[model samples]
Target: MADQEPIALLLLQKCAQVEAAAGLVTAVRALHGPSRTAPIVLLTEAEAKTDPKSSSVDAAIPIHCPADHAARELERWRPVSLEPTRRIAGILGPGPIAGMIERLGVRLEAAMGMLAQERIDQGEAHRLAGLCGTLGFAQAHAAWLDLSLGEATSLAEARRTTRLTLAAIARGL
Candidate 1:
């Protein structure tokens, strides 16, 4: 149900009227509570020059921009999923905990495959490391850090770390 919450507010600006868009953004923020986490994105005409940060909008993208660029902007505004920490579990109930663990295991397996192929990027490695820590897989977190920081010396070492991390996940501790 958390995913059902509003991800963002998208306002369409016709004819390059940034002032109107800004006003709408202000109204939206006021109505939704100024502290709302959902970002407001303005879609403007190609020639419209809007500075989103100055107007309280999270992002402004031209309607004519490339699809990938638009998608990237939307993704930038997407809310990050809450980690399955004890506090979160208490609030959201225990049902999500098992699901989170399963998801983390799947992600770790994928990361290990990427590591084997030398295709894992530092950003992904760092993210996985954080997830491991959140899930209480300390050794896996350390191994992820080693991979992320280039501290692991060889492919064999990386494989070993991956196996160890998998084992930790299997142990469910």
Candidate 2:
């Protein structure tokens, strides 16, 4: 793989399709110079633990994390409001907008997964609310708003609400 290739993008879904496609690389390489190596590898928690292939990875950072952790660890952070983003997208075209939406989807999935795993705290609701507001995701925003507003008296309730929001987003509603 070229150094410029992304290291990986592990999806929650089963990666049999990826594996099947990977099996054809050699055949394609014979016709072309070389098939580009897909840097994205799908592995679940169980696979991460038992799969020897994972050992070769230099780093395996979780996309899901807490707000404080995100602030301290991530670089060059900034929020993009939806209206402005749409205006820019109109000028630039649908490509940029599609990429932005895809990125937001990934972020949401990661946050939801972390919340499910109990890896993040209630403050994460605020962080997610901010993200939803910036992204103009109304349903997600409502869920985060409820959690952040202390409508949920317990962490379990907050998680349940978060899960529902995650489901809604996943359904593209």
Candidate 3:
């Protein structure tokens, strides 16, 4: 725990998906700065409480999450519209303009089990639920814009899902 070790992203994928995103964004921003160096471990409610130590983890970002709770908080740190989308896409890929959107979906699918089992607390569950909603909404929107990527039934359905997902996120917020 003390010795500096090579960083390897351990996608615990518990429910802190939004925090993971933020951690990535923070890392990227830090690289741009003069003095910056830290390790990030995006943990869900269960992971952190179970094992608070990691040889590879320098710090644990215990995001109060159970799914998309970060999205509500994320709104404050959003990439200022165009820039954020571009930044996220850059990290995600050339898959689509919604590269981040889809990654978010993947994140949601991974966390669903944890959320459903209620492996976390009430507050964390609510937060994670919000993140799930946000990611799901983003995924629906992106899938519609480009069904070639798959997962979308129809543009109308996509819109409906996005609306619902957005509403879910709003509710959590």
Candidate 4:
């Protein structure tokens, strides 16, 4: 058992004609020990009569469910965070995009601080808007546009909107 391969997810099929779920689970425990915490999901047809959970599996899902639904369910076992830098990396590969996002995030935070202090001007607002547009942050670009156009009622309001937009961009939206 020392040479047994580790399992990330154990998927078992449940069929009425042949019941192999319990035997498989026992084999897995024998190979990996009872301390193995890998998720065991049972795949079954929609009309299957057996209760999948009764087989001691973690979860039971239909075989033909939507891809996203299946992925979401599997995410409970292994979670991945899709941050803005990762999203941009998917488009441009892992290179300067991370540094670029970091620089832009820092700059956006600085701009917000400047707005809070009433030190930001229309020229800086226009520049920030252009940068945000080039970086694909549409909401931040819009906020900068409003600030540059003097549409914001006050500097505090501008800062608030800028903070919100920058937060949204940070969230990978």
Name the best candidate (by lDDT): 4
Clash number for each model:
0, 0, 8, 0
The regions of model 1 sitting more than 4 angstroms off are 1-93, 152-158, 168-173
Off-target runs (Cα >4 Å) in candidate 2 are: 1-93, 118-123, 153-173
TM-score of each candidate? Answer: 0.41, 0.34, 0.20, 0.41
| lDDT of every model, 2 decimals | 0.57, 0.43, 0.36, 0.59
Tell how far residue 83 is off in model 2, in angstroms.
13
Worst 10 residues of 3 by lDDT: 32-41
lDDT of 3 by residue, 74-144 (tens): 33222112333445446665465354444444443333333333333334334433443333345434433
lDDT tens digits by residue: candidate 1, 4-66:
344234545555666786676565545432123345556777634433223454346888989
Kindly report which residue stretches of model 3 are placed more than 4 angstroms away from their true locations once superposed.
Answer: 1-97, 121-173
What's the true lDDT of residue 165 in model 2? 36
lDDT for model 1, please.
0.57
lDDT of 4 at 101: 59
For model 3, give the RMSD to the true fold.
Answer: 16.7
Estimate, for each residue in 33-151, the C-alpha lDDT of model 4 and write its tens digit: 31243446677776333322244455667788898987876664441123543566778875666566567767876785576455657888888888766666655677687788886
Ranking by TM-score: 4, 1, 2, 3
Indicate the TM-score of model 2: 0.34
Which residue pairs show collisions in model 1?
A: none
Order of quality (lDDT): 4, 1, 2, 3
